[model samples]
Target: MSEGPGATAHRAVTVRGPLSDARASEQARGDHHAAPLAAASWLLTTAMDLHRMAGALAEGLTAESGDDAEAVARLTSRWTSLHRDGGPPAEHTRLEALVEIRRPRTRRPALLWQWSGADPVAALAASSGRLARELVAVSQAAPLAEAFVGPVVLAPETAVHFVHETLGHSLEADNYRDYAAGCGLVVGSTVAGPQLTVVDGPLPGLETSRPRDDEGHTSRSTPLVEAGVVAGVLTDAREARRQRLPRTGNGRRAFGAAEALPRMSALHVARGTTPHAELVRPVRHGLYCRGAWGGGSVEEFFVVRPACAEWIEDGELTGRFVYGFDVKGRKISGLGALGSVGDDMGVFNPVTGCGKYGQELPVSMRSPSLAFDRLCAVPIAPASPSPPP
Candidate 1:
């Protein structure tokens, strides 16, 4: 609850490649009866591109390390692309890659990554290369002994995760009630800044887009937070009736056999007019956080670990910093601390799956870079140093 000495501020950043809505439509209109050989050719081309990109990235890292065998221990990937017609149409393609950078004497951690979009091969290459660089930096840096507790910026990619965990989850009718079953969230509570608006619905061509819920309910855009106020919460028919709230068409099931529950589709934070530089320029000392490996929550309290982060001095990135701290805080409090939002919005191809009960649902998030004024980051002990050879 109290800021400690050595406490520094932090922010988050994520870069996603471009996806063409037009191309998605074109694909939808193209002949559905293409030859099997043509489909096979496309898959082969994508596979080769991924293979080349991974090899090149590993080679670059190895060259920098001055060891031929230290660049990569193993590289494995899985690819899935399918097109289906019937019951409102369904089409999807995905590539998941794991890259392990070899180190002397110690077993290095593997980077588990994924991509889905119009050009997944290109996305995979770019993401993989960026991750390799981060791993190298992580290996050479010293862990922070003290935690940072203050203002921070959440990069577009990081903001997506932050919003999803803190805002989106908190706005779920069931989840919110589970945590506040007796008191419940106030409908008009001030949850964030005036510039922060959150929405959940279908954005066709994007990864989370769906024409209907698993129960065959037509999808519609629902505003969860409007201009900093709690406009609404995602709910299914049962929860809506139980709570006397309106159904927002968010009821969804993981599969045909699973029961329906309230779930988010393409949840995103509306962008603002502020230039990204404006968000960081005023902060004399803070962090530029990037990437979300994964995180967990209990009630309204949550902890998220960034994949990589850098020190920000005088509003500019200064040096790469060890990322072993948990950005921990209460959900509402975190959103309330929003300082500014940027115009650079990113809609990531859904990679991480959201799970509740015994089912996993595919979800996507979009957000601009966001800044928060007083948050907490608790230092986590770094992974033990590798044993000497």
Candidate 2:
């Protein structure tokens, strides 16, 4: 079978007795050794099927784009042997695809889409549709009004990104070592209300789950925060050794990445007991941020642009607002302002790249609707009106 660039095949053989005798005895054992081989075969078949589906999707996009738009797509299929070091390797396969579209001679920003999952088709289609709708809405949207600062209820999806950007990245061991940043030094410090907890690990059945990291370390769930107190920080071998901290198995390397680093896999805020309705019911006047576009951080402070938001009045949604707003605050302060956490949660595998040290890795986050008190929401400069056509 054809493999992508950097793909490597691994094999191992064990003989309990002399080769001839072992083979004869194994044959008499009733094909017990065949089980692993069968499983590996099935995994390979699945990966090949996903590859074909990706190719078909690319072809369709190319035809639809015609010559006006340039389209580029790539599919990467990863198969890992879970028990490679043991009796027989357990095969694991992961598929990720990315599609980029740009209209030549136009000043519009290029649209990027990405997906990662066992089923490539469904993930790809969902990402493409979401990107298309977002682009259209952004292009047609009018200038927004001044943003209201204070209490706000973040949608589940928006909360996922917020927790990822504000907490996950800030807790990386490298960030702690390099800049003296992160919550590492603040272990046992209460950073939020008792209802807030954050976790990071290779959660099973998730698109980002894995048995081991790139450095051959076994994966385990690590609690970054629990009951509002700092619990732990993610660590790779180097950082763990330097800081004399236990490794959390967070070492990860991007495709074609030269070196492994401490990167989050499946990071999320644990769900709270608060019902979904009650989380927003107490909000008298606030914004309900449903989505986000671009965001980044400078040290402990962070900023994210809301893609779409609605006004909340009398503990209910008023209407979809058209203006852009910036959510800004220090990480710890933002968490400390948590009014409540909802029971309904949303998981997201983002298409936009999360860049660090010039390398981008696949990551996922999940969180319930979160309400914050005393946070700043400032209006962005109005978009320049389209030149009179």
Candidate 3:
């Protein structure tokens, strides 16, 4: 038995006593326990098989490692709310549930594998104090500067931030079909370099990583672009068959509500020979885009609200870009201005989800702190969709 993110343990525990059917019923019926929100807690005690194996593997993998990390403390909780709408169909009340997991450490215990039936708070409380302390230590000591070194935790929001802004929604087949609104940087027609490529997959161990898609399709690695050449788009079952291209396991939806599209998972641009220092060394004055608050782009126009940024002087990063400059430019020019690429990749989490055509899907995108020769900084503004045909 094993526990945590990479754990592979299987076991079950049963509690025999007075069932709380009454409490659950009361909560559902708007009684004393029935409120806008409801919560439950429990103490999960394993027979110690999973945790023991996890400890052994951790020792083997981290032998002589200098970096400090937390033990795996995965807290997956869900929040539900009732919705009533008046529309074409009829007036109805619907329940929506949101599930999330927070595995702060490199190693998680067996609790990560156990599901408590839609209740996330109880799963978190099951962990001991030792795990909590480890998480705290990792948070306090681990600086974002070390992001260039190894695998870092990327929540869903951040993952979507990278994908939507960097890769996922940008390279859709439809987007490139007839020079659609924001799809000018064609795969084979774009830039040229050995370091430049685009890849998407449902690789195991990633939050967006899944063995099969919603259409019962098996996952496979598909090259969106190879060394600046057009490879293909992230196609779903329909698109794959329509275009006569193999499915890339991209068909997915937001909890089975909306239709699937050519979504992305584990999307990234591979690293080049440039060291982290050299990647920024050539820049005498430039910007570093860490994350995005909000922005939009068209094939002719792309704008981004920088989460954080700093200035470069003689290859050294000065203080944060206090002038508050942001990134704005055309897709072709933007991609053309790229001076260097990093070897970093961002993975999926629960926070960020891709939204398109009234649907949202899971995704992740990776890239180094790319350097650009000259990036136009424009002010943010209210979004106005392009004029309809």
Relative to the true structure, candidate 2 reaches a TM of 0.69
Off by over 4 Å in 3: 1-163, 178-184, 256-258, 294-300, 323-325, 344-350, 381-389
Please, what are the lDDT tens digits per residue for candidate 1 over residues 202-291?
A: 875467677766545677888888898878888877788988987777877653323578888789788888898898888888877776
Candidate ranking under TM-score, highest first, comes to 1, 2, 3
Clash count, predicted structure 3: 16
State candidate 3's TM-score. 0.56
* Tens digit of per-residue lDDT, candidate 3, span 101-177: 12335432211222232333333344323233232332223122311211121222222343355445566644555
Model 1, 364: alpha-carbon shift in Å? 0.7
- For every model shown, what is its TM-score relative to the native structure? 0.77, 0.69, 0.56
List, residue by residue over 281-325, the lDDT tens digit for candidate 2.
777887777656667766777787767666677788665455466
Q: How far does residue 381 in candidate 3 sit from its true spot (Å)?
A: 5.3
